[model samples]
Structure formats: structure tokens, C-alpha cells
Target chain A: MELFTPELGLVFWMFVTFALLFLILAKFAWPVIIKMLEERADMIDKGVVYAQNAKEQLDNAKSEAASYIAEARKQQAEILREADKMKTQIIEEAKAAATVEAKKVMDAANLAIEQARKASEKQLRQEVSAFALGIAEKVVRENLASESAQTKLVDKLLNEVENKN
Target chain B: MALAALLLAMPAQAAVTEGEGEDFNPKEIIFHHLGDAYGWEVPFSHSQRIPLPVIVRDCQGSWHIFSSNRLNDGASYDGFYIAHGGEYSGKVVGEQDGVQYRPLDLSITKDVAALWIAALVVLLIGFSVTRWYKKHNMKAPRRWTASFEFLVEFMYMSVIRPTLGSKAKTYAPYLLTAFFFIFVMNLLGLVVIFPGGANLTGNVAVTLVLALCTFFITNLRGNKHYWKEIFWPDVPVWLKCPLPIMQAIEVFGVFTKPAALCVRLFANMMGGHMIVIVLTLLIFIFAKFGPAVTGGITVFSVLFSLFMLLLDTLVSFIQAFVFTMLSTLFISMAVCDPHEGHDEAEA
Candidate 1:
């Protein structure tokens, strides 16, 4: 019977003690602890989101850099090919100009040589005609010294002229 | 050492029985240990008790305060005495009109002192955890604070949060306090020394107050749908119209929930303490058969007591958890949305 009994003093003290504990805890302790826990959870969640965003941005930057490098390489190859083509065309043009200049110089030399040969041939003909005339005159003079020879020569000339007519 | 101890205890038992010419009575011995007293008893000595304050009111409504030792050995002080065997046995009684009557005993008994100690322990834990959170500002806890935080978080997240959902925060303070309060008392009751041996949770008055708190919180917070389900449940019209059977059962169930909560905790803790005391008493009961019987039974009794104490330690934790979990469920039942229940019922 005593075991089952609920004494008045015990009940009063229990209520007083338990109520005091509850009021103090609820007002001060629980709020702070639970708030800090929530704040920490929120902070961790934000940190994870921020990390994911940073990773995505890094990936984007990496791909963009790779594309830029590829574009620059392509441009470099195009420039190199254009320069090679220009070098070959310039060489061919220079060779053609050199050949034309050499041909022009050879033509001028041939014309000059022909003119020089013609002039020399004309001078030699003139000298040969003059010499032959002078030799004939000397022979005529020597033959006239002998009177009889002169007369005979004149008659032979006249006879030849008549025969010709 | 145990045989020597038992042999030494034989003289004390002989001395007690010699005065009364009676054999050892285990019932009175167990009850004395299990029940509350105005003074704390020293181990191995019944006469030497640590005096505590005794505040009592006479039948004429006059309050008096004095040390409990003044009333030792059937002594009386200022018309007040501790009744030996009567309707008010073990209580401060006063004579009125040739009739025995109990006073308004607001004295701090052994159990009340232990209750205050348990409350102080809970407050210490609460403040320590609070201090850590305040200083660190969301940083992790360590050592005792860490273990305490783990218990709180586990209870909140697993039991309270799941059942109460959004309303968990509203009721968390009371629920968490109850959990720690009961758990601390249960653990304190397991110790056999100063500030530990009082059976606070096993006391019916203490459990009644705790259960009443749960009962009031549940019923006070009950939604409109809850009352409707209780009074006019979605049952056959015949049950409500003719018999009112379901309504009666629902109303009965509302009171039974808290009642069961009170009795369950009280009975478990009380039974555990009783069993330990009973086992220890076995040694004295077997002492008459000779030294061999007494020594053998002492070993058996001591071993069994140790085992039971270990078992009670686990039961302390489990009972606290069970009480808290059941309270959370009951509160959730009252506060939950009607639609969720309707869906479940249909499924």
C-alpha cells in the first residue's frame, strides 16, 4: 500500500524542480544549441554549392582555353602555308626576269657584230679597187717609153674597139 | 572476503533478532530499503542515519522544522512522531482527538533530495552543452559535450523529428528535458552510495508527474481532427448511434496512454531494485543452516546481484528511451494532419 501511494510533498517538489528545469532549458539552452546546429548545417550546404559552382567555372575555362589554343594553331598553319606559297612564286618570277634580261643582251651583241663586219668589208673593197688602178697606170707608162710599143698599143686598142662595134 | 563479510553480518542480525525474539524478516528489510525515509541510512548500520531536515505541519496546522534524528527509535518531538504501524506508517503523525493523523509533510525526504540532485545533474548537462555551443558558434563539441550532443541530436532526429516533423521544434524542449531527467534519475538510482541510491524514477509520485506532463501536452495540442476522430470516428454508424462503443474506447485510450507510461517506468525501475535487494537478502536467509550453506549461498547471491545490477543499468537506458519514444508518438498522433492518416488508412 505504501509502495503504490503518491505522497503530496514528493509531487509538489517534482513539479517545482522539473518545471524549473524545463523553463531554464527552453528559454536559454535549447534555443542556442539547436540554432547553432541549424546554422552549421546551412553553412555546410552553402559551401557544397559554392564548390560545385567553382568546379563548373573551372571546367568552362579549361575548355575555352583549349579552343583558343586550337584556333591559334590553325591560324599559324594558314600563315605558314601562305608564306611558303609567296616564297615559291617570288622565286619563279625572278628566274623569268633573269632569262629575259640575258636574251636582250645577246640580241644587242649580235646586231653590233653584224654592223662591224659590213663596214670592214666595204673598206677592203675600196682599197682593192684603188690598188689595181694604180698598177695599171704604171704598166702603161713603162710601155710608152718605147715609142714603137706605144703606137702598137694604141692601134691594138683601136682595133679592139672596132671589133667590138 | 565475501564469507568473512557474511559471517560478520551474522552477529548484527543476531543482535537485531535477539531484542525482538524473531527470525530475520526479509519483507521488512526489503521494504525499508526500497521505500523512502526522512533520513539517509548509513551502510551496515540502521541506527546511525544521516540526519536530514524534517518540515511537517501538525493537525492543528502549525508548521515545525527540525532534524530527522530527534525522532529516532520511536522518539517524539513536539507532539510529532513517525508512526511505526498504522494507516500512516512511516509518516509524520500527530494525535488529534485520540486519533492518529498524518501531517502535511513537505519535508525534503531522501527521494526528494535525490530528485533535486538529479535535476541539478540535468541542469549541469544542459548548461554545459549550451556553453559549448555559445563559445564555439557552431563548431563541433568534444568529450562530455560531444556525447551529450549526440544523445540530443539522436533523439531529436530519430524519434522527435520523424514523428512530429515540423512541430518538433515547438515541443523539443519539454521532450528533451524529460528524456534527460528520467535517464539521469534512472542511472543515479543504480548507484549504491550517497546521492545515488534513492529510487526517484521508481517512485509513483515522480512518474505520475512526468506522465501528467506528457498527457497534458498531448491533449492540449490535439487538433480539431483529433477530437473528431475520438468522438465521431469514421466507423460504422451503428457503433456510434446505438452503442457508442468506439467513442468509449477512444476516450478510454486517451487516459490509458499516459497511465501505461507512468506504470511502465515505475514498475520496471521498482522491480529491478526489488530483485537486487531480494538477492542480497538470500544470504541472510540461508545463514541458519551453518557456515557452509551461508558461504555458498552468499557467493551465489552476490554473483546474481551483480548480474542483476548490470541488467538494471541497461534497463535504465532502455526505459528512458521507451518512455520518450512513446510520448513522441502520442504527441504526433494528436498533432498530425488528418489527410496523412486518411491516406494510410486507405492504403
Candidate 2:
């Protein structure tokens, strides 16, 4: 008994209003709305994908930069090593040249000292021979002054000369 | 004015004096009336009386027989005390242990309180859902918004899209709105959290209105093809002879579809409520005379009631789906061009 009571007027109006509203919505509103929603979703998805790719690219670039920096450091160390080697070679060559020059100078001074000592020794030998000859001459003159001794001395001298001959 | 004067003069003569014997408590009588008439008492003991034929009011100030014992737990008061039948008139019994109370006068019991409670629940649910929507941004649709979107998608894909085809997107808003509205309303009927104890979906008027809306939309949007199929048929000469009769019947069929929608929703919701009420009443019927019977019946009632409640929850969703599906089917049929040779060739 409680189930079927009718509110006739309300039922009529509800039908009318809903019919009008649905018409307007179906014709004008729904298509634009759904399209907009789908577009928005697609845009967001694209943006996210782009951001991810950019981040990956950024990471790659950072790694490449780090490698370049490392390579530069290595090249700098090689150049410094080469410079040190060149400096040491130049110093060694100069020292060798100075050593040769010093040896040449020492050889020349030794040659000059040898020549002077040879000349001095020759002159001293000649002077000593002359002094010996003079002393012998004086001794012979004193002996000849004794008379009988003179004749003997003369005969001895003759004998000595003959022996010498 | 006449009625009021009559009421006052008649009641003045019947006033009772002190020491004229123990007067019945009018408040107890009123409470008893509410409990007995519609089972509005609090259900404590299983042996308590089960109220039958509960009555309730709606937001429109209309009275209706909401459910039989089969659909609702007879109204319980203060969480106990199944109301027993009574009608008594007496003076105020004064305060008893600091609790002030009034006696009751003889009157027929009504269930306006129960009806009010049901309305309040409907209002609360509406408020809560609206508040939830307003508090959160739906542009990006997070959490609950996403959940609602999925639900809307499911309904569109499974129901409207298949039926309406090219026009499905255009019909999605109406279909989705109707689905949610009916779903929420049906769910409200199953939960009893209001002051009095009411079931809004049990009311026939609401179902009728919803059905009427579907009816108008279906007919208003009908194209030439729909009318042609109903009013004329392509058949052999012999069949064509009786075409007029068929056309007349087909015209009636148009109205019947929406009528069926109304009845289907109303009946299912009302039927589910009745079953739950009856299961609850079983406890009182079995336990009225003894504690042992009462204890056993109480357990049985609780289990059975829970089962029915679960079924009602499922039915609420199903009814909403069925209504939307049928409406979509009707609209699609109306808008489709049956005379198109392409469809005929394909078939």
C-alpha cells in the first residue's frame, strides 16, 4: 500500500527539465570538453618525456666535460716533464764545453813551462865546463916557475904530449 | 479555530486531581506509541516487541509507509527498549531522581522522527561529498578525484560508449551524473546514522521522479528513425495487414521502458530494506517469552542481518548500473538510423 503513490506534476516537470538540459549539453558542451581534456593529458605526457630526455643529455654533457678536464691536466703534466728534461740537457752540454776549455788551457801552460826549463839547463852546463878549463890553466903556470923543476916539468910535459898524441 | 476551541474545552474537563490514584506517565505513553507503531524503540533485549509498518516523513512534508518488518529493524529508542503497544493518558509525573519527564495522552503513533533522521543522513552525505570535492582541486585529480575518474570511465566505457557509439562522448556527462546521483542515493538508504531512523530510497516518489527524467530524455532525443520503427514496419503483405495493431502496441512500449526503470529501482531498494527488517524482527518473535530463546535468536538475527546488509550494498551499486545502462540503450536506439543501408548490408 505504501509503494505506488504518484506525484504526477513533479514527474512531468522532471522529465521536461532533464530533456532540455541533456539536449543542450549533448549538442554544445560535451565534444569541446572531452577534446580539451584529452589534449591536456597529451601535453603533460609530452612535457614529462622532454624533461627526462633533457636531463639525460645534461648528464652526458657533464661527463664529457669532466673527461676533457682530465685530458688537459694530463697534457699539462707531459709538457712540464719535457721542459724539465730540456733544462737538464742544456746545463749538461754547457758543463761539458767548460770542462774541455779548462783542459786545453792547462795543456798549453805545461808546454810553455817545459820549453823554459830546457833552455835554462843548457846554459848552466856550458858555464861549468868553461870554469874548469880556467882553473887548470892557472895551476900549470905556477909549476913552470921552478928552474930544475922546469926542465923536468918540460920533459914530463913533452912525454905527456907524446902520450896524448 | 473551531477545532482548537473544541480540543481545549474537551481536554480541560478531563484533567485529573492529585491523590486520585497513580497517574500514567504521558511521556512513557508517547514513547511507547513511537516504539510500538513503527518499531522505533532502542533494541536491547531480543524479547522486546518488534514494531511493524513503520511510517516516516520526507523533506517534502509527505507521510509514507516506508517499510514492513521485513525491510527495517523496527525502530529502537536509546539503543534499547523495543516499543510495546500502548495508548494511555495521564498528568505529568514530575521529576524522578532529577530526571524530568511528562506523561502521554492516547493517540495513534506516527514515525515522523524516523523520517527526519533519514533526511538528515541524506543531507549529511550530500554535504560531505560536496565538501570533499570543493576542498580538493580536480584539475589534476588526485586520490579521491582519481578514484571518481576511474568510476566515471568504467561507466562510460562499459555502459554508455557501447550503446551510444559515435555519440557516446556527448552522452557521458548525463550518464555519469545519473549514475553517481542514483548510486549515492541508494547507498544513503542502506546506512542508518540519523536521529530517527529512515530510509530515503524506500520512498516511491523519489524513484518516480528519477524515472521520469530518463523517460523525457529518451523521447525528446528520438530521431526520425525511432519513430519510423515504431509507427511503420517493413514486412511482407501478410504481416503488414496487422501492422496497425503492432504500431499501437509499440507506442505503448515507449512509455513502458521508462516505467520499468522507475519500478525496477523502487522495488529493488524497497525489497532489500524489507528483507533486512524482517530478519531483525525474527529476533523479537522468537525471544518474546524467554532469555534462552532470546539469546539464540539475537545471534541468528545479527548474522542474518549482516548478510542482508552486504547484499543491499551490492544491490545499491547494481541498481545504479542497470538504470544507467538501460537509459543509455534507449537513447542510442532513439538516435540510431535504422534505415541506413550500411547497417543492413553489414548484418
Candidate 3:
């Protein structure tokens, strides 16, 4: 028999089989395929959403961490600066106290030395005056014991008193 | 045999003699059997040939547009002639002709008519089940609906969705059309017996057109990334140097990819058809030799053809899937951003 000849017999039989098979497949097979497709689409969509959400959360976390680190560094710097200032102030106060204490010790030493020198000078002067008085009394007693020497002395003294008057 | 007798009776003088039963050559038999004295005819002259969508023919000196399988019964077969080139001298069919020549017509061709019927049946069943669900006012899907729903979900998750992503919904119609079209064509090949046994999927022209559609869509929707890859690919200096040569080669590669898509599908489908037909022909050849040979060859041919038909049916679905997947891959490449990674790094 020639192939591809258009015979109603072949055509009719083929049509019937085609219809039967198609109906069976549509009823039994196609739905299953379509349902599977829809489910797969949903799963993919969910995955995409999950990924996006994860990415956003990650970004937020990173920024938050960066900001927190910056703030901590700033606080650390401030603390260091305050500590430096306090150290300098303590050193300056210590130096000033040392200077004031040294000044007071020097003033006390000068006062004690001046008082000792003045007392010593006063003693020396008194001793010198006593000695001068003793010498003068001794001289006067020797002259008065000799009568001639006493008269000459009284005349000279009279003449000197008259001339002086 | 009846049909052969009818054809032989048509015109005795022009009739090509059939070889003697035992001496019959299979190739000669097939050639003579299918050969027409008048080759395909078109009405337009050489000057009038313009590449467009019309097939005009001049048959027996009558000028007419060669339309195949028109809706009208007798008029459907009247327009065109299919014959060997030496037997008849008419006009050669080409794209240059103002008319588009479709080699196969679904409405008129016997096997395609069967396929059309099958498609209708599939559509009807789907509608009926959906209607039943609506009538019941069920919140959940009924048995038939549920089965279909599950299949769709499975395909979406495993196949379509993964390849195309969330935007796959936008392409669902085309994907569905491709799947059903391939499935129906495969099924028809199994069931129908008519001219050339109607291997619709086997037709290279059909596959070429389908591949072309994918190619166009991929290119049309291309983003910066796709073009960048084509025009200025990020390759090593050794590969990228000699700008003109690499650029030319890369551009050619883009076109070749789609061409491969067309050729692969066409070759696979046509190869399967040819194998099945050749095997089936063995039965006739054996019958011509002797009855003893007939029985053995017939059994083998039938079994082998059946096995191949089942395989072909599966292959049809797989081919459609591969085609769609490649299409999605190409389009995704086109639409993806070139600088996305860099932007992410900066962020």
C-alpha cells in the first residue's frame, strides 16, 4: 500500500484514537503536570523573598556594627584625652608645692641666723663697756692716794673748770 | 494496495511502472510510490517573486496560488502538486516568492488532522474538569483539577520557575504552548498513518521557525550585560587583543548558538522518523520476497516501531523542554545587569 495516501478509513480511525488518547491524557496526565509547575513557581518565589529579606538584615547588621565601633573609638579617645589632662595638672601642682615648701624653709633659716648674730653683738658691746669702766676707776684711785698729786690735780682741775666756765 | 490501484488507474500513459515483486528495490518503490509527475507549481513569474507570505503556482498552465489544505473539501487538494523535479518542470518554491510555502498543513494533511483532533480532545477534557470544579463550588481542587494543579506545580518548581525565575509567569503562555504542541505532535506520530506518516516535529522548517522565535525574543529583550558579553567580553588580554578578529568571531558565535538550537532539534526529530520509516519499510520489502520472510520481519518492524514511537514521544517533551530552557537561559543572560557585582562590592 502507498504511504500518505488520504484515505477516509485511515483518517477516521486515526481521529478516533487521537481523540480518545487526548481525552485520557488530559483527564489523567495534564493536570498533574500543571499542578507541579505551579508549586515549583511558588517555591522559587518564596526563596527569592527569603534571600531579599536576608540581604536586608545583613546590611542592617553591618551598618549597625560599623556605627557601634565608631562610637566606641570616639569614647576611648575622649577618655585618653581627659587622662592626659589630669596627669599634667597633677605634675604642675606637685612642682608648685615643692617650690613653696623650699621658700618657707629658707625664710626660717635666715630669721634664726639674724637673731643669733644680734645677741652675740649685744654681749660683745656690754663686755666692752664694763671693761672701759673698770679701767677708768682704777686710774682715779691711784691719783687720789698721792697728796701732792692730789693738790696739783685739784688746782689744774680748778684752773680747767674756771677756763671752761 | 487499493489506494495504489486507484492512483495507477488515473493516467496510464504517465504512470510509472512498479518493479516486479521479488526484484523490487525499496528506495525505488518508495520513490515511485510517492513521486508525482507534476512538481510543485507557483503562479508568479521570476520578476514578481518577492519574499513574503504567499505560495503561488501555475499547474497545467493555470496560474493559481498554491494553498494547501484549504477549508473547502474538494478545493483543498486542488491548488498544489508534489512531484519529482525531472518528471515535471514548473516553478521552484523559495522564500523569494511573495507567498509563504508551508510544507505541511495541519488542517488538510491526514496525520495533522488527526493531531488537531487530539489537541481539541485535550483542550475539551481540561475545560470539562475545570467546569465541574466550578459547578461544585469547591474551595479546594477536585480530583482532576488537583492532579493537573500538582503537575503544574511540579514543573514550575523543577523546570520553568528555576530557569526563568519569578518572571517565568510572564512566559507561561509560550511555554505551555510549546509543551502541548510538541506533545501532541509526538502523540500523533504514534497514532496516525497518512502521508509521510506526518512527523510534524521531524520537519526542520518547523524547528527552525521555533528557534528563530526564541532568538528574536532573546535579542529583543537584551540588557547591558548581554550586549557587553557579546561586544566587549571580559576575557584575558591574549583573547581580547586583535579587537576586530575577536569581535567578529564573538558576534558570529551569538548567531551560531541559535543555529545550533535549530539544527539539533531538527536532526534528532528527523533522525528518529527516518529510522522508524526505514524499519517499517523492511516489512514490505520482506513481504515482496516471500511469505516466510514477511512474518518474521513484520513482527520485528512492529515491535521496533512501537518502541521507537514511545521513545519519540518522550523525546518530543524533552526537546520542547530543552528548547524552552535554552531560550530562558539566553533571555536571562540578556536581561541580567553587568555591573551588579561591582555595585554590590561598593555597597
Candidate 4:
């Protein structure tokens, strides 16, 4: 078909028309359009970067705060442990002091008891001798009237006294 | 007589398309529709039509300009008649001293007028957009500016960004312009009502010129790596041998790529026009049987033609998009760095 045929004049005109169209668009239209695109992309990218930086800073602050709390908790535990140890030492020292005081009181009481027991024994010997002497005097006065009884008793007593000396 | 009634009824700008008898010549009607015309045919008005201005240069290099009605109204003025048959059939021919010489018929034919109309409209739109950008450069765009900006952004991403990548910024001006130009031309072709329905892209001359531009840009800017890849592909030694068949095919591919791009657009667009014409012509074909048949088929014909028109509009936009995408793809392939090509192979 002649429909597929080419015409030179029309071809030439088409070239001229198209070239003019292209030139005008390229010069007037494209730069502004492209710049707008570039600027918008840059804006989006900067926003993302800013968001990421903020998130990172927030994360850092959170971690630091957690570590601070952890340190505070550890200090609290150490203080409690120290208090517990001090309470045990104080209890043990108090126990030792009470034991010493009790032993001193017991020793003092025992010495006093020993002193009383010696004194009592001495009094008991004195009383027993006195009673024996009284009885002997009474017997001597009443029975000396019988001469054989007094002489035999006096000789045995004198022999016993000489052996004791 | 049936063909005359049918022709008068059809709302086409084709000047002369009638044939003899029931064997109606659809070719004459179709070609008349496709070809340049002297005057636009107004339906049901045999003596009345919209006349185009005829401009022609004589053998003496003198120019004659007049209304096309003079040539069509059963008359020839100053020895020049719009030829009705043969290769120069719708063009003006001058009978200079007994020799029928075809002068330089440089009239603003139907498609040429359409092209002018398209160019002016595009320029007006572009100027308005530029103004809008100047005033509201900082704020978000509204109305047509928003849609236009969106289109620009889409081309930038889909065609420019993927193909050119980093160098997209550099070639954005040309790529964006080419996209809009083709899109507008195709869009105008779909408007059957008013002054917009002329097949500019269907003309081989126009598509050839467009393809030539792509060819020039692709090759002129084509790097050494591109040419090298064409000549020496990464094939086995045995494959590279055997009369350099692969290399020859690679080189041939470069030329055919643009040819294919232009032809595909032209054929798709022209095919739509043909189908619409044939569908409408069927009613007249059925008229030969009886008035009953003609009346019955007219309703169906009108409905199918309406459907075709809607589909044609969609095709127009799609064709424009395809042409722009392929042209950008070719340019990208030509100017891409060797490493980019390597990356493609790896991918």
C-alpha cells in the first residue's frame, strides 16, 4: 500500500516541528521538573537520616539510664549486706560480754560463800570445846569427893596432854 | 447510487471514495480517509464541504495559493487541477504547455494542519505549566499542574530512572519532551469530533522522522562499549566464528529496533481507523439487499463503531507510552556504562 510510502517534504516538516518541540521542552520544561524531583528526594532522605539519629540518641540515653539504675540497685544490695554483717558482729560481741560478766559474778559469790563456811566452822569448834570444859568442871567438883575416880582420870588426861605437846 | 448515498451519509473528510455497483470498493474509501485531502467532506452535502487552502509552486518556481473548493467544484483554475487518479491522486497537478506536471503541492494537508494544531496546543500547555511552576515552585501543585507533574514523575521513574539510572538527570529534558510529544500526537488522533481527528502518526513520513531522531541520538551518543558489544558479543569461540553471524545480527538489530518502534505505532493507530471505517461501511453493504436489512444493520454498526472509538482512545495513550518507553530504553542501552551492561548480564 502507498500508505507505507514516505514523502520527503512531510518528513522534512516533521523533523523541523519535532526538533523545535524537543528544544523548547528541554530548555523550558525539564530543568525545573528535574530539580523539583531532586529536591524532594533530598528532603525525604534528610528526614530519614534525622529520624535515625534521634532514635539512636534515644537508645543511648535509655541504655545509660538502665545502667545507672543497675548500679544503684547494686549499691543498695551492698549496703544491706554490710548492715547484716554488722548486726551479726554486734550480737556475737554482746554475747561474749554477757558471758564474762556472768562468770565474774559467779566467782565473787563463790569466794564469799567459802569465807562464810570457814567462819561458821571456827565458831562451831569454839562452842563444842566450851561445853566440854563446863561439863568437866561440874563433874570434877561433884565426883572429886571420891578420890580414886579423880586420881585415875587426872593421870590419864596428863599423859594424853604430854603426848599432844 | 447506493455508494453515493452511503458516502454522503458517512461523516468522513475523504473527498472522493465512491465506486461502481454493489461491489463497493472499500479500498478507495479507506485510502481516501488515510490520504491528504483538499477539502474536508461534510456529510450529506455534496456541493458543500470545508475547503483547505492549496499552495503549490509551478515549474517557473512561481507560487499559486487558493482555496481547495476551486479544484473540487468541477473546475480547474490557472491550468491546475487536483489530480483524481494515479500516484499523485489527491495532489495538485499543473498542465504547463501540454505536459501534466505535478508541482510542489506543499499545501497544509489534513495531517499537517493537525500537526500544527497539536504543536500550538502543546506549547500553550507547556507555557502554562512553566508559569505555574514559577509561581508555586515551593507549594504542592493543584489542578492540571498536579496531573502534568505526576506524568513527568512517572516517566522519570519508569523510563528514565530505570534505564539511565544516574545519568537520568542529564537526559531527562529530551526524554520528557519526547514522551509528551508522542503522547499528545497520539491523543489528538483519537478525537473524532471537532478539529482533532487526523492520523499524523499513521503517516510513514512522520514516524520515519521520529525514528530517525532516535537513531541519531542513540548512535551519536553511543559509547565505545555499545559498538564493541555489537561487534564482539560474549559468546563461545565457535559461536563467534561461522561468518560472524551473531555480530552481523547484532548490528542489524540496531537499525531494526527503531524501525520496529515506528511501524508498531503507525500500524496500531492505522488499524483502528480501518476497523471503524469497515464497520460503518457494512451498513451500506447490507443496503444492497433491502431497506429492511440496511435499517437492521445500521443500529449494530453504530454501536460497534462507538465501541471502536472508545478502544481507539485507549490505544492512543498506550501507543504513546510504549514509544516513549522503547525510545528511552534504546537510548539507555546505547549510553550505559560497560559495568551496567555487565550487571544486566549477571542479573
Best by lDDT: 1
Report residue A69 deviation for candidate 4 (angstroms): 12
Off by over 4 Å in 3: A1-165, B1-25, B28-82, B87-151, B194-197, B337-347
Clashing pairs in 4: none
Clashes of 3: 41
Enumerate the candidates' DockQ scores in order. Answer: 0.53, 0.09, 0.04, 0.36
Instruction: Please provide, for model 4 over B42-140, each residue's C-alpha lDDT reduced to its tens digit, 9 standing for 90 to 100.
Output: 554545667777788899999999988888754798788977777767677888788788887777666667777777777766666667778977565
The local distance difference test score of each candidate is 0.85, 0.56, 0.54, 0.76
For residues B138-233, what per-residue lDDT tens digits would candidate 3 score against the true structure? 344557666645434545555555656545655544455455555556555444233223554555444555566667767887777778777778
Q: Give the residue spans of candidate 4 off by over 4 A.
A: A48-165, B1-24, B40-51, B237-242, B341-347
Order the numbered candidates by lDDT, best leading.
1, 4, 2, 3
Q: What is the TM-score of chain B in candidate 1?
A: 0.91
**Cα miss at B161, model 2 (Å)?**
8.1
lDDT of 1 at B133: 75
Any runs in candidate 2 off by more than 4 Å, and if so which? A1-47, A91-165, B1-169, B192-264, B284-291, B325-347
Chain A TM-scores, candidates in order: 0.67, 0.62, 0.61, 0.57
Native contacts retained, all candidates in order = 0.74, 0.22, 0.09, 0.59
The TM-score of predicted model 2 comes to 0.49
True contacts kept of 2: 0.22
Model 2 Cα interface RMS deviation (Å): 10.2
